[model samples]
Structure formats: C-alpha cells, structure tokens
Target: MHVGILYSRIRRDEKLLLNELRDRGHEVEKIDVRKQQFGLDRMTTDVSELDLVIDRCLATSRSLYATEFLDSYGVTVINNPRTADICADKAKNSLALAEAGVPTPNTKVAFTTDAALEAIEEFGYPCVLKPVVGSWGRLMAKIDSRNAAEAILEHKATLGHYEHKVFYVQEFVDKPGRDIRVLATDGEPVAAMTRSSEHWLTNAAKGGKTAAFELDETALDLVETASDAVGDGLLGIDLMEVGGAGSGEYTVHEVNHTVEFKALNDSTDVDVPARVVDWLETKAAESDAAEAPIA
Candidate 1:
C-alpha cells in the first residue's frame, strides 16, 4: 500500500507511525505541506495514486487546508476534512458532544467582553476561559475572581483576531489531580492513560505525569459516544472524573483530531503505532474497494 504522510514537521509521534509503516513494507511518501503549493485546479503531488494520506500537520490551519486540498483532489485522508473542520475549534468540539447527549462540561460562547463577563458571572468564579483554536493547554485561564475575569476579558477584547474575541467559557470540573486520555479508532479504544498533575492544567504537554488506566464500562461508553459525536477517526477522547474524585462518573471535555500518542505509547504496553497502522490498512482497503472498477 502507498501512504502519504502530510506534515510540516515530523515529531516523535509521526516518527513512530512512519517506522511502523516502513517496517511492514508499505510505500510511504512524505508530503511536507510547507514545500507544496495547492490550488483549486492544481496541487504539487500526485495524490491520486496514494492509498491514504494521514494528516500530521502541527498547525490546525495547515491541517485543515492541506486535508481540504487533498480531498478536493480525490485523495483519501484519515480523520477526514469534515471531522477536522468540527474538531479543530473548541466551540464546535463542545457543541458536538452536547448535541450528541454526551456529558460534557457546561460551556458557553459569547461575542463581546460584556457578554463574556455575564457568562463568567453566571458560572461564578473559578471557571475556565479558553481560546477557540488551541491545544496543549496554552492560553487557557482559570478566571478565579471577578477582578481576574475583568482583566482577562479586557485583554482578549483588545486582541485583533476575531477568535480572541470569541470567548469560550466552561464550568471547571474539579478533577482529582488527573484526567484520562483514551486513544480510540472509530469508537473503539486502543489504549488509555491517566495524566496527573498538581496544577489545574494536566495536559501531557503541560508536564502531566502519565500511567496506564483501566477504563470501566461507563468510561468506555462515553468514549464511544464522544467518538461518534466527532464523526470518529483516530481520536483522543479526554475525560475528567465527576461525582467527586475517583467516583467513577466521567464528563468528556474534548475530542482531538491529529491526536499525538507518543506519551500514550511510552506509558502503556500497547503497540500504539502498530494498532494505528492496522486501522490504516483497513481504511486503505476500504478506499480501494470503493473505487475499484465494477466487474
């Protein structure tokens, strides 16, 4: 099978998948988005011949556009453009979960600082303010008081970008010093891990400690629901404990597309890359079958 990896920079997560694909004798094409030019009528690479293209672009904007271009050229890409479109923004991620009846943290979006202030006040102190398009916990503020809320709102209102003005506020769930990251494919769990930290932000990118986690039935159910809500690709379904610490109840906060799993591979015995490739091979076969000439 021929696979094209779409990336700007190849991180460890991408390296692992690349090595696995090579070791299995699959032909891999490295398509660097930076070096390529794309247009409505043309693109740099012969994407039509590739069995699949896995999007690994670090920037959300690049990932969305690159996949969109490939899809327009009739190439198959994992975590399709439609899924990327929905998962790329925090507001859309939250709405998908809620609309699917998945238990997510209470969230609200406001266009102006005054409206945001009203939302923050309604949720009371210690809620979260997050950028609409971001990851790894960057620019996420825990607005702990009226004074802090006013300051943050003022700062965001002054930023020139429209996204900065689009305030995303959520009721902070008091997680018990940890949260869970489950890497799933099409609503099925590949492996799970708990990211623990003393600080409020427990993302692995924020120095969170990780270890393998055993998911209960309820957690599994939410994982499946969240995956379907986001249209189910290679997803990172994030959950926090509800009903108190270690109480078994869970609230899913977000679902990630282009999910990084190097930490997950390190902390668990699961052959993460191999499992992901197994899924890729299945996807490739499906694409081939769908496009095959009729007898």
Candidate 2:
C-alpha cells in the first residue's frame, strides 16, 4: 500500500512508523507541509495514488489545514479533519468528552481576564491555567494563590494573542504523583503507561518517568469512551486516578490527536509502531475496496 506522511519534521516517533511501514514493503511518501502549497481545488503535491495520508505535522495549525485540504482533494487521511478539528483545541476536546458523558476534569473557559479570575475563584486556588491549544505541558500554570492567579491572568491578558486571552481554567486533579497515558486505536487500547513525576505536570515530555501500566476494567471502558468522544483515530488518552494510583475511579484530562508514542514504545513491551501499521494497512485496504468499481 502507498502511504503519505504529512509532516514538517520527522521525529523519532515518525521514524519508528516509517521504518515499520518500509520493513513491511509498503510504499511511503514523506510530504513536508512546509515545502508544499495546498490549493483550494488541488495541492502542489500529488496524492492521488496514495492509499492513505497520515497527518504527522508537529504544528497543530499545519495538521488541521493539511488534512482538511487533503480530504477535499478526495484523498483518504487518517484521523480525518473532523477529528483533528475537535482534538486540536482543548476547549473542544473537553466539550466533546463531557457531552459523551465521560468524566473529565472540571473546566471553565472565559474570554476576559476578569471573567477568568471569577472562574479561577470558582474552582478555587491550586487550579490549573492552560493554553487553549498546546501540548507537552508548555505554558500551563498551577495557580496556588490569589496572588499567583492575578499575576498569571495579567500576563496572559497582555500577551495579545486571542488564544492567550481565552483563558482555560481547569480544576487540578490531585493525582498521586502520576498520570496514565493510553494509546488507543478506534477506542481500543494499543498500550498503556504511567507518567510519574514529583512535579504537577506528569507528561513524558515534561520529564515524567514512565512505566508499563495494565488497564483495569474501568480504565478500559473510559479509554474507549474518551476515544469515541474525540472521534477516534490513533490517540493518546490521558487519565488521572481520582484519589490514588490504585483507585478504580479516573478523570480523563486530555485526548491527543497527533499523538506521539515513542515514549510509550520504550515504556511497554508492545510493538507500538507495528500495531499502528497493522491498523493503517486495514484502513487502507478498506478504503481501496470501498472505492473500487462495482461489478
């Protein structure tokens, strides 16, 4: 099968996938979004013969626009534009999960600093202030006091970007020194890991130690529900144990669309890239069969 990887830079995660696809004798096209021009009617890069296009662009804006353009050109794109649209924004991500009855962290969004402060007070101190669109725990604040909240809000208000002004305040879950990251495909678990750190943010990218985690029945159900809520594809569903590590209860905090799994591969025995490639092959075959001429 022919696969086109839409990306700006190929990281270790992308390398793993490329190696797996190549080893399996699948034709791979590395389409650099930075180097390509996407036209309304067509793109400078020809994707007509590709069986599938995977959006691996590091920038969320690039991922969304590229997939949307590719989709408009009649090419099959994994984690389709609709899914990308919902997952790229934290506000949309939370709404989708909540509307689907998935237990997520209590979140509030406000347009101005004053309104945001009201929300922060509502959730009380030690809540979190996050950028509406970001990953790897960058620009997230754990507001511990009124002073800290005022300072952060002032900073964000003056930052000038609309996204910064749109404050995303969430109730901080007192997770027991760790959080779970489950990689799933179409609501099914591919592998699970726990990211543990003394610090508040426990993302692997934020220097959290990782270990393989076995999903309990409740976790399995939440993972599936959260995946479906975000329009499942290859996703990283992040959940925090409500009370402690062994607690059966959980609150999902985020679902990532362009999910990076190199850390997951290292933390678990699962052949992460191989499993992802297996899913890709099935999707591509189904697309081909669906598009074939009728007898």
Candidate 3:
C-alpha cells in the first residue's frame, strides 16, 4: 500500500504515524508541507495511486485550494479535507461542543475590536483571549482587566490580518495545576494523561509533566463525544477542570486532529501507532470492498 503523510517537518509526533505505516509494510512518503511554497509539484505527483493520506497539512486560505484539489481525486484522507476540519477553529469547536451536549467553557466570538471589548466586559475579567485558529495554547492570553483586553485587541488590530476579524473569549476555567488529554481513535478512548504545571499552559512543550490517568466512564464518554463532535478518525480532546476547590466541572477545551502521542504511549498500555495502523487498514479494506466488481 502506498501512503502519503502531508505534514511539516516541525511536527515531531507525526513521525509516529509514518513509522507505523512503514512497519505495516506500507510504502510511506513524507511530503514536507513547506515545499508547497515553491509549488505543490511534490504533493501533486500521482496521488491517485496512493492507498491513504494522513493530511496533517495546516490549511490556510491559500492552501485550501490545494486540499480541495487532492480531495477531489478520491484520495482517502483521515480527517477528511481542511474544510471538514475547519471546525478545529476554537470558536467553532465551542459551538459544536455545545450542540453536541459536550460541556465546554462559556465561549463567545466577537467581530471588530469594539465588539471584542464589549464581550470581555460582558464575560467579565479574568477571561481568556484566544485566536480562533490556535493550538498548543499559542497566542492564548489571559486577560484580567478591561485594559489588558483592550490592549490585546488593539495590538491584534494593528497587525491587519484576518485573525483580527474575530476574537475568541472564554470564561477562565481556573485550572490550578492539572489538565487531562484523552486520545481517541474511531470512538474508542485509547489513552489518557494528566499534565501538571505551575503555569496556566499545561502542554508538554511548556515544560509540563505528564502522568497516566484512568479512562473512567465519564472520561471515555467525553473522549468519544468530543471526537464525534469533531467528526475525525482520531482526535485528542483537552479537558480542563473548571470552577473552584469546592465545586468544579470538567470542560472540553480543544479538539486536535493531528496529535502528539509520545506522552500518550508512555502514559498508557495502549499501542498508539498500531491502533492508527489498524484504523488505516480497516479503511483500506472497506474501500476495496466498495470497489469490488459485481457478478
């Protein structure tokens, strides 16, 4: 089987998927997404022959056309096209979670700097300001005052990018020291971890430490529910404890399409890569069955 992995070199975890595919006797090609800058000639060569594509391509509006180009050719993509995963936008993620009855932090989106300021005032101080399209807690600011909110909004406006067209504001969950990441594949919760740090960001990249956690029924249900909400083959759901010492709730924070599973493998007994390989093979089998000739 010929498999294509479309991702950037900076994606350290995507290597796990590639290695697994190779181990399974698939001819895996790692297509560096940065090469598209010169042109997509690298990605455009005979993709029709490939059995599967794990699209880790971070789609900007410019790259969306390329994704559509590939999807039109019937290449099996793990999370569908960039447009299908566009709900990865934090604002949209919140809305989808709400609709799915998956508890998420109180979140709102505002267009225009004035509207953003007004939303901050409405949501009140100690809320969070985040870009709609963000990951690993990057560019996520905790605003404790009206002035700080206004300052961030003004700075964003000065940048003159479409990112400023809307701002995501959510009620701060006040997670003291820990957050949970649930890794799910095909509606099954595969691994779970609790990351602890002194800082607000508990991502492993920020020097946070990880430990294994039980995938209890609630956690499992949350993982399955969030993955379903995102409509992806595999997903990583970030859950944070909201409220204070006495009363709190576990709320969904983010749904990641392309996830890092090193910590996940270390934290659990699950074979992360093997599970992904199995999912890919099942997809391939289903495809073959669908294309079989009828008597």
Candidate 4:
C-alpha cells in the first residue's frame, strides 16, 4: 500500500511511523503540507498517486482547504477530517462530549472581552484559558488572577485575528503534582504517561517531565469514553483530577486527534507505532468489508 504522511516536516514520531511502515513493506511518501501550494486542483492532482493519506498536517484556516479537498476525495485519513474539525473547537468538543454523556471539565466560552472577564469572575480565578482552536498547549494559560485574565484577553485581542472571537475558559482543577496523557486507539486505551511540571501547567511543551504510568480502570474508562465521544480511529485524552468541582472527580482537560506518540513510547511498554498501524489496518479492512459486493 502506498501511504502519504501529510505533515509539514517529518518529526521524530513521524520518523518512527515511517520506519514501521517501511518494515511492514508499505510504500510511504512524505508530503509536506507547508511546502506545497495546495487547493482542490493541486491536491486532487498530487494526492491521486497515493493509496492512503495519514494526515499529520497542522491545519489552519488557510490550509484547511487542502485537508477538506483530501477528505472530499475519499482519501483514507488516520482520523477523518471531520473528527479533526470537531476536536479543533474546545466548545464544540465539550458540547459533544456532554451530549455523548462523557464528563468534561466545567467549561465556559464567551465572545466579548467584557463577557470573558465576567466568565472569569464567575468561574473564579485559577481557571484555564485556552484558545478555542489550538494544540500543543499554545495560547493556554492558568489564570490565577483577574489582572492576568485581562492581560491574556488583551494579548489575544492584540493579535487582531479575531477581535471579538470567543475564548474558552475552564474551572481550574487543583492537581499540583501531574496530569495524565492517555492515547486511545479504536476506543481502547493503548498507552499512557504522567506529565509532571515544576509549574502549574503540566503540558509537555512547557518544560514538563514525563514518566510511565499504569492505566488504571478509571483512566482507561476516561480514555475510552473520550474516544467513543470522538468516534474516531485515534484520540489523545488529557485527564486531570480536580478539587472543588465535586468530591473525588476527574475532568478531561483536552482531546487531541493527531497525537504525538514519541513521549508516550518513552514512558510505556506499548509499541505506539505498531499499535497505530494495527488500528489502521483494522479500519482499512473494515472499509473493504463494507464495500464488498453481494455474492
């Protein structure tokens, strides 16, 4: 099978997957989304040569057209474009999780700056401020003070991208020690690790340290629940324990569709790439089964 990994540049995790596919005798192509000028015509022309596409590109509104084009052309993406679209929006993820009966953090989204301030006050300080659409913990802050909240809003506004766009703020959960990163494949927990930080934020991008953690039943359930809610082939569930929301309860902080697996591989006994390939094979087989003709 010819596989095209649609990423900007090949990272370590992508390299690992590439090696795995090569070992399995699959033809792999690297298509850097950033380097290519993509549109309906360009993508349809370029991607026609590949049998499948593992979408690893960090899509912005600008690059979304290409991703959508690939989607429309029925390219076999690891986690369908629609799944990425749903996970991209914090508010939408929360609402969908709620509707699916999956528990998420107490989240409040406000459009105006004043309404954002009001939400901060109401939700109380020490809340987590996140861009409605982002990844890798970018533009995420733990607002412990009213002034800090104002500053974050001002900073976001200064960008001039969305002067009046809403931001997502969630009640901060007090888990001073560490947070859990669970990668679920096909609605089952595959690998997990605990990320510890000297600072309050336990994001790996923010100088956090990762260590192996056994997936307890609760962690597995949380990961599985999030995967089911996403209804995708793969999902990365960020879970944390919080106080003050309710006694002895956990809330999901975020869900990532295109997850970084190298960190988890370092901290667990699981073969992250092998598992991903296995999951993809299962999905591919299912698709073939669905398309088989009646005898």
The reply for model 2, stretches above 4 Å from the true place, is: none
Q: Which residue pairs overlap in candidate 1's backbone?
A: none
Q: How high is the CA lDDT of each candidate model?
A: 0.94, 0.94, 0.75, 0.76
Which is superior by TM-score, 1 or 4? Answer: 1
Comparing 2 and 4 on lDDT, the stronger one: 2
Q: What ordering of candidates by TM-score runs from best to worst?
A: 2, 1, 4, 3
lDDT-wise, the better of 3 and 4 is 4
Give the number of colliding residue pairs in candidate 4.
Answer: 0
- Which portions of model 4 show Cα errors greater than 4 Å? 35-49, 60-64, 243-249
Alpha-carbon runs more than 4 Å astray in model 3: 36-43, 58-66, 82-84, 243-249
How many backbone overlaps does candidate 1 show? Answer: 0
Per-residue accuracy of model 3 over 1-295 as CA lDDT, tens digit each: 7887877653546767777888778998776666654233434456767777776765544234455556667667766654344545777778778888999999888888898888889988899889887666778889999889889998987877797678888888888688988877766877888888999888976778998877666667777887787775667788886664223357888887666778888777888888877888888777767767987
Per-residue accuracy of model 4 over 95-211 as CA lDDT, tens digit each = 878777776888888887788889899999789888887766777789989999898888877777772367787887788578888888866878888888868777887768998
Model 1 — TM-score against the truth? 0.98
